[model samples]
Target: MATPPALVFSDLDGTLLDHHSYGHAPAAPALAALRARGIPLILASSKTAAEIAVLHAELGLGTAPAIVENGAGLWQPGEGSSQDASDYRRIRAALQALPAALRRPFTGFGDLGEKGIAIATGLPPEAARAAARRQHSEPGLWTGDDAGLLAFAAALAPQGITARRGGRFLTLSLGGTKAQMMAQVARRYGAPLTVALGDAPNDAEMIEAADLGVIVRNDHGTPLPPLDGEASGRVLRTALPGPAGWNAAILDFLKQLDRRGGARTDG
Candidate 1:
């Protein structure tokens, strides 16, 4: 692939979409600008491939891929529904193998079913079904105490499974992060100047890894702490929240690139 001027990686919830409404209408302008410049926009989210594919097509991202399952997997464009549930099965099997005391507290999506997921996430029945279609990670509510949680993770570690707490759920994965997947995707695009936008602790690594990082305002979640890049102005925080903030940050950065004569035109 020829080197593009830039590539953008963005978190969906609380970043590119309204935290409550889950709409990106406010970001239409910036989305258009990116399209006009032929810049690839990769949606990075904990959403499953089934879930992300709908939005990927809705956003008209063409062949750009997405970082899905909280970076546990990638969703390439044009791919049909994934038949490979091997990783998901492995993770579930690992959980079942744990002691009942360690296992009973974690109520995973497999245990929740579609109706339970819909109630848990406020997604509609169909959307919850999509969310439940896990391929590489399992997210669940951890009812165990902190010590038990620690023990749970420790036991799984030997099996190559890792646990991360994000929002209301404890997510288990075989081990991959948004930053790692971001680098892999950037390399596919010829490593163009990268910009990453996100609004949570899970996004910190990817934000720090990019050429420019944007911390989109998120009133619904805990604010990200000041990052090292902020001191050098390589990272910026948006004044507004959600997609509106995403729009302003992206447009401003594009302007800066334009002024520096660095914004590459589409060939």
Candidate 2:
């Protein structure tokens, strides 16, 4: 059998899941349909590993891999609750092995509990300021206290680090983009097709990289700026916004696929 795309990397907040501050529900039938299809719905978000775990458990996706801290860390599922001990040790060792000048700062709830970690950098003044603005406006929405948060973002900036916003918090990374992470996952799973959906600036990378990029609308039914107007053919900007918008976009892609004999792949 030809390998179907094993992964659908989704931005949690404002894309697959709504931002209700907390206690948000995935759009029922849409989420159910994806789950039913046996497609691995990967939660790619700016959320900390712990925060993502809450959603993962709620969604009943046990042991799925997550691209956390804006791609600074790839948290693979292990035999038990947390990352495999050997894998965890490998990541730690790899991180420590880097020169002090090259290493980026990071933290997580797993550092606190089974939740996970949130890492940050202390470079790039503009990015650090941008992230600080977002995190300050919404406290407790992320895993850090004020000091940790600033220090977290700051740690990444100097090493050419930056943060990408999604759902509720800004994700700090040494220099990773959502598109790069999505591609990595696709290569790992041998996914022939990747249908990605997201809203907000942080999602631009994946939106640009996917075989089909679906831009979800906001609550007022306004499509965001085209990811790249010069390359308008690459994106399907929707008239609908929010969860309802995503529902429409995905359904449309499936319909288009069916009409074309499903030859659409390899963006």
Candidate 3:
């Protein structure tokens, strides 16, 4: 049996890395297995490029591009391209321009500085600084009623902005989403069998778009909203949390794929 070329698109904070500990130690086996199979692991995260780049390097992913800032844009290391880098200033301006009622309850990282970000995210001062170096998106805390949140998002939509509720904050970015970026990357790789894992609603689009959608369990014990798509039976849910759940799903899927003879096998 043969298998199609495959790649994995994953969320960071709660999918590949732990939510509280911020480590992927539990998924080490899966990480090693993916490397062994020569699979391309693309990071799709709400974290800024500066933050994703640091983790990517530590993971030994050499110069591989990442989908950063909640898909506000992509980051290609060593390539002096991508217009997303300069979009932050404009985004901030847009936020301020929103009606005072729509904007007042939200406090973004840009407004907080590194120290604020550190306190908000529980990252150390140094790590928080990296998180604060946002290029394409604005992640912030929303301190308002649900109705106000909806109103804010609606207001931003007319201005080519989007608000996504992440695990810890509400992220504002350009209209792009993980699904859009995932499609672009899929094209770059000749449209191989795509597998995506995520644990939050902000990730619903990408998860539904993948050939194999895996909803990993989150630390809060709440699963994401239902992933609606035309591809039935292609979506799956993991029972374990963090990387352990991530590992379980990938291994299980690979076994099913091998049996189905969907693509070329690495071994």
Q: Which number leads on TM-score?
A: 1
lDDT of 3: 0.82
lDDT of 1 at 254: 87
- Candidate 1 wrongly placed segments (more than 4 Å): 143-149, 264-267
Candidate 3 C-alpha lDDT tens digits along 126-145 = 89988887777899999998
Candidates in order, TM-scores: namely: 0.91, 0.62, 0.90
Instruction: Give the RMSD in angstroms, all C-alphas superposed, for model 2.
Output: 9.9
Tens-digit per-residue lDDT, 83-122, candidate 1: 7889899999999999998898899999999999988878
Candidate 3 C-alpha error for residue 135, in Å: 1.6
Clashes counted in candidate 1 amount to: 0
Give the deviation of candidate 1 from the true structure as CA RMSD: 2.1
Evaluated at residue 205, the lDDT of candidate 3 is 87
Backbone clashes per model, in order? 0, 21, 6
lDDT of 2 by residue, 1-267 (tens): 244534567776667665443233435655665555556677776654555655677877755677765655455655223432443343334435545544433332223222211223321444333223221012122444556546555654554546455544444445356778888878877877887777776777787788777777655212246677328565776665556666676666666655765433332
C-alpha RMSD of each candidate structure in angstroms: 2.1, 9.9, 3.0
